[model samples]
Target chain A: MAQQPSSDGTAGLRELGEFGLIDRITASVARTENGTVALGPGDDSAVVLAPDGRVVISTDVYVEGRHFRRDWSSAEDIGHRVAAAALADVSAMGAKPTALVVGLACPADTELSWLDGLTKGLADEAITAEAQIAGGDVSRADVVFISVTALGDLAGLPAVTRSGAAPGGVVAIAGTVGNAAAGLAILSRGFRSGKAYIDAHRRPQPPYAEGPRAAEAGALAMCDVSDGLLQDLGHIAAASGVLIDIDGSAFEIEPRMAEIASALGQDPRAWVYGGGDDHALVAAYPDRSHVPEGWRVIGSVWPVPDGGEPAVTIDGEHPEISGGWGHFAG
Target chain B: MAQQPSSDGTAGLRELGEFGLIDRITASVARTENGTVALGPGDDSAVVLAPDGRVVISTDVYVEGRHFRRDWSSAEDIGHRVAAAALADVSAMGAKPTALVVGLACPADTELSWLDGLTKGLADEAITAEAQIAGGDVSRADVVFISVTALGDLAGLPAVTRSGAAPGGVVAIAGTVGNAAAGLAILSRGFRSGKAYIDAHRRPQPPYAEGPRAAEAGALAMCDVSDGLLQDLGHIAAASGVLIDIDGSAFEIEPRMAEIASALGQDPRAWVYGGGDDHALVAAYPDRSHVPEGWRVIGSVWPVPDGGEPAVTIDGEHPEISGGWGHFAG
Candidate 1:
């Protein structure tokens, strides 16, 4: 057995090794507010109580230099972002996140402190969502890769799915839109200003509680705005066999956003329509009257025309810009 | 949206894109035997029934080159190995694995056929475990990284943790040991004739059913032999506050293993004692008289001496060999 070092020196993961690091990290796991964690972070597996007799599970991966850059985001930021994104998936399905299991792969020489920060970020986010860090696995890799699997309790509500949209439904969003994409653009172009956008990109605060609210309000379909507004709406359209027509003017361009777009000489509408990683819950309702509070109608769904593709149109017209963050499409 | 090509020519992931590839792979997922999968895939999240109102969860990460080599293992082999390893963890807790959510990070230029083979392997292994492919997330990365999160149901049984071993308990193993390590050595030494050993290194078949049986028979403590016989037992010993003494002669090393070790000019005992990735289940029982069928008693547990560390000994003596597959250790 290896002993933990008494001093808090700058020892890398290689010095501590796998089990040693695991012990260090496991010791630091904060007691969570979630009472559903029957067992946490030990033994062969963790036991979690699923009060509803059902569990909603969603997983997402974040790779260094692809999903995020170490130079642009701190370890804490990465952890928070990953946790939020995973939890948002559960929320998109109209469930309350109960626990998360993280799988982290990083270089052998990674700083122990970096991992501590990352774990702190995960714990903090889990706490905000009223969930617990159930269990995780760590390994050695060339670049940092974090895979988060979030488990949620549906609380006896039917899961809102992308395939449930009806022809007369209205599409709405429960969280901010396009801010993360704008932040990414600002960071990529070497812009130092735009604190709000930059923060949105680094730490997205997905509306976690609004998901079940929307489902309870009779949301016909739901998804997270992870792959931009239009592209994700396209998913609902295709899945539900409906044509979604967006009222572009419904997305009010704030003065700050307009000013930033002017400085960058870019279109704010492009960001609003094509930006991603916002983790906003987008859902469709039978009518605007039934749309839950904090959710604003942005579009309307219609039956797909015969021999026509299920599509998303801006102001009833096809937009010139298309697609958003396809991992394999360069 | 990119359309799937009619012909299976030389199209890579880059050509087909993320959504297209996902559609291709998802279409191949087979129906699972476990009835817990309420909703499988193609949704914002997967819904699985926790019939016992409790879920056992575990996760593991497999990185290319660090955990396995493409030259040594096929996509199918990698998928099978990861799925088996993850399911084994759930089994170690005396639970029936219900579902798995996979997170894959690979290069954009990766061949489509490779991913197809990988998905096929995952589906095949899920079937073997009677679990379903619940859902997954795919992203772009420099190298292939697969994270598997397994969810299981306890079926009204208490979870078997590593801290329950009594002083008078006997340590036993329900699956083969050292075969994976021997296979790895054979592969490293470039011995192509040891097909069994090499295959074992590529794919481990754990006795999933025996875990619940051991628990029902009142096994005290249990864990999967993922980090070698001695190292993993050390975990149980430390957790249970007991010392375990192994009878080395109890491990019946087959003639094939001896022949392979002879060819490689290595001690087979080292592999048996310190080999890993076999994923065999090791348990502590009250005595050999109550040991379940298919399980062989390898040692006995005793109370730790005062002011002494809980430890493992071979034949009443400390073994010279130490350590097993520490991911960050050289």
Candidate 2:
């Protein structure tokens, strides 16, 4: 919706207008000279060369209050987190991310500087993943909302779907698990912590290269830990018609997570098992010895017993913990 | 922004919850067996086969109350309109749309049936365009917002960019113009005409097949008229260093638009020149004889006057009407 002109004489989005903002944002975006991008932004559509003849595509949406609060995280943090989450999905499919198309909506009063920072963050993450910012659309909304569609190159490898895990496979994980969840808890409690856990919540660095490495190492199935380790692994278990059992003793909790949990009078294990948004890659391998170097073997896959449901278990028992992040449930 | 549980027990989104609502919405989406989509929804990311080794990508965002008011349009209408708008961009690039990935954000109190209708609308549009609904993401927001990314195949043709127009080219248009604007005007007056014009505003059917045909016929430059004729053409004119001059007499204004304009005591020419969202394909042909069958030759391109501004003119003179839609300007 259109808003009244700012009477305070501040330069707002309404003053800069849509085309002006687009020009500014596009000009600021760093364009990498990648051969995969046949045609970049400034056109109606971008043409990307899918060298392997196939493209891996995924989309994710982030709402201002629901996914992140402007009061809690900077615009750059939000942009980086959103880009990482979307790219991680492509990585989970064992694809090399190529480009990203962003769709953003914000209130008319938003500052141009905020958009500049957001674009820089998007470019920064895209560069880190060796992907380019292809193109994007901007619109007006009540609050800031971002939607990212990531495109990836599979490099001629078969996609690692959730249904590929076998009963004899060993489950492994790369990257941290519960630091983001702990950071979120600390922030929700109105406490400011300068620990790495707080930054993990603000910006998650997914194990990008580890996905394809696992795929090359003969990984049977893989997924990113966006909805907690147990919940995400449960999806693989259900799809593969197998049981996934995690050994609690195999997990070595980070000292930062332990300290934060102790300060909050909570168990760090819950955060490791039930926390979401870490964007860690968890994969299934037929043999533990064949697991990639960076991955830690934390569990094993088993056949579903007779008519019993394919489930996830901790230390040979069902844990009394609730499922990970559900937007409506929360 | 989670909403309180509906005390009236009307089966709101909160009651259905995120996963349940996702299942319901996803199940309703129609799946067409297209070879381009190697893998569809239900995975972390979809795998699409880019047989031509290149893919065309574009994205658009639609915010409720800003882009479309619920009181003015049904959920199905909103879905169809958003899909068409995104696909039209790919079409403008002389590509055949192959797939769409939707990202939706809504409040927790949304109705389940509404989402079903929305999903149906998306599927209907995708099927009509011969594209598959590859995958999507859903999240909670304070209000309804949709982001659609469209992927397309070029069928081995070189992409037609806006900067390719030459001085001797003829400007042509496919599909109608100004009907949507007239419809909006009539609706704003609280009058329900139930005419084609009103329906055009609610759901625009872009000329998808004409894009590739125009390219085959040797169109030099092309674009979709989403931001009105003059404004969109201005982009081409500026990019190509050419001036486009329209022959006002060549435009055959539909009787419906004329009637609506007469009722509101407004000139229909203004709507024809300044209307947006019609998604009409405007192109520059080397000659008028080369224009496709469904296209009407409305104007001709000329070399920019020495040191003068690149512009659009009507009947060899500059018009006095305001330009088309701007998100912030509105």
Docking class of 1: high
- Best-matching candidate per TM-score: 1
Global lDDT of model 2? 0.86
Residues A145-242, model 1: lDDT tens digits: 99999999988999899999999889999889889888988999999899999999999999999998998999989999888888889999999999
Q: Report the lDDT tens digits of candidate 2 across residue range B1-330.
A: 223434443577867776676666566674644667998887899998888899999999999888888888788888889999989999999999999999998887787667766888888888888888888998898899999999998888999889999998899999888888887887888898847878888889899999989989999999999988888888899889899999989876777667778888888887888887789999999998899899999999999899888899999898887668678765
A175: Cα error in model 2, Å? 1.0
Cα lDDT computed for each candidate against the true fold: 0.88, 0.86
10 residues in a row with least lDDT, candidate 2 chain B: B1-10
**lDDT digits (tens) for residues B145-218 of candidate 1:** 99999989889999999999989889999888888889889888777888887888888888888888888888
Runs of candidate 2 exceeding 4 Å displacement: A1-10, B1-10
Q: In lDDT terms, how accurate is model 1?
A: 0.88
Clashes (N, CA, C under 3 Å) per candidate: 0, 0
Per-residue lDDT of B304 in model 2 = 84
